[model samples]
Target chain A: MFTPLTVALAVAALALAVWCGWAAYRDQPTKDWHFIGMAVVSVLALAQLAVGIVRLAGGEDAAEGTVIFVAYLAAVAACVPVVGLISLTERTKWGSLTVAAGAVVLAVLQARLHEIWGGGGGA
Target chain B: MAPETPPREPRDPGGGPSDSDATARRASNAPARSAGIGKGPGTLLVTLYGIFTVGAASRSAVQLATRFDEAPLAYLLSAAAALVYAFITLSLVRGGERARRAALGCCCVELLGVLTVGTWTLVEPSAFPDATVWSDYGMGYLFIPVILPVTGLLWLRRSRSHGGPAAVGD
Candidate 1:
């Protein structure tokens, strides 16, 4: 629910998307470094999830209702790792592109999270 | 994984060395066939469809559960879209001649659904109290609902051709 964290996660996600897209453009598969990038984004997303849960427990409410907000948080936390695993299975340029697609989706979800909270939970 | 092992060539049993060599060369040049439909760009398509499956299914599930009376048609359409996406995603992962054919057929139906829903929403916006995945040609989801089926059809056709080698071996 923190403004800075949401923005940071979106930025990190988009950056990861661009990095993975570049790898695909170079006709390369996802490498160890790309997984590291996924980890970085995942960590931030997990932090956001934690913050959202704690805030909800503290009696704060999301504008879009608690259930959907929590669902989005859980989804955000799970996105990158699952996509990374899928990419790991296929060692080709398309694997890189898959990660890129996942990262872009993560960024979109992050924006929606902000909207779901009514853009009012600023730190 | 597996240390990126070289693609295995099918045994020719009584074929000459030159024939085996040529087969190995061909196999290396087109590994997509051996790897199945889930390889190459299909990997990306599967990922996208997987996401859409989760997105549309969960969204419709919630909508149908909470407000079935308000917009039953739209929510039901959303659920249908989710099923189509899930089927395609599974068929891609379960690669083979039969799975490829099933996916191709589903892709055509999906394309038709999107076009019909898109036009219906445009021509009569008041009819839909809420948007389905295909509403306005998937404008809500960046028009991916329309584009995905077309892409899936192309990929399926290409994979079918690539399956020729594997088919002969089977």
Candidate 2:
């Protein structure tokens, strides 16, 4: 079950990925461009983390809280920087492809995190 | 004939560079990777690997640290896989003969890890009470864990013959 925010972030990332792909077709991806794409992703991830915590705090309970919580933390930290650094180093089309890949991964993880919170046995 | 070495130029200016010369330039530039920028996809792949390493390691760390009792086998394996991802990412970024060799090793292990864990879990469900990154051949991550290593190895092999700095991807 994807949250509204998740859907929004995913869609935004997808759109950016498409644009980045076009940019790659054109050539050297500047750092400023990479920053814009990643900043959005970073914000969304943090929001998911916060919303996740709030929901968890509500005490719905059932899933393995330890595993779920830890995965959530990992998911949040992992998505943002990895994508950013990869783009920073890559000044060509592959960088855009990489961003696209990361975007896809981020969207998927966001959904997974949501499921973990909703208790689909993440822990 | 040795592959033509494209002059060491990181950024090509202006519009769609789909020409054969441009294509050749991009292709030939595979080994020249050192300090500063790399081609886009290489950048992205390296970044993705780095992310995977961090995410996997943290998950393994937390899993092992908090409750080794829960599923020690799976958790320990998860930690090991995370280390491999990190190593591969480093090799990709480092872009050298030795780094390439290290990446090759990591990729081989990754292939083995996914197969071993994935098959073990399926054949004996009792073994994997919880999922690790390689559980089900990284089905959770869309099996990229299985696919990536194969691709990495091929790339490394392909780059070896060319033997140019550009082949390295920084």
Worst lDDT 10-window in candidate 2 chain A: A61-70
Q: State the displacement of the C-alpha of residue B148, model 1, in Å, after optimal TM-score superposition.
A: 0.7
**In candidate 1, which residue ranges exceed 4 Å CA deviation?**
A119-123, B1-35, B164-170
True lDDT of residue B81, candidate 2: 88
Question: Model 1 chain A — which ten-residue stretch has the worst lDDT?
Answer: A114-123
For each candidate in the order shown, give its overall lDDT on alpha carbons.
0.82, 0.66
- Lowest summed-lDDT stretch of 10 residues in model 2 chain B? B32-41
Candidate 1, B85: how far from true, in Å? 0.8
Q: How many angstroms is the interface RMSD of candidate 2?
A: 3.2
lDDT of 1 by residue, B122-162 (tens): 99988898889999999988888999999999777865554
Candidate 2 residue spans exceeding 4 A from truth:
A25-38, A46-78, A121-123, B1-9, B13-40, B165-170
- Clash-forming residue pairs, model 1: none
Please write out the lDDT profile of model 1 over residues A14-90, one tens digit for every residue: 99999999988876778889999999999999999999999999999889788889999999999999989988876
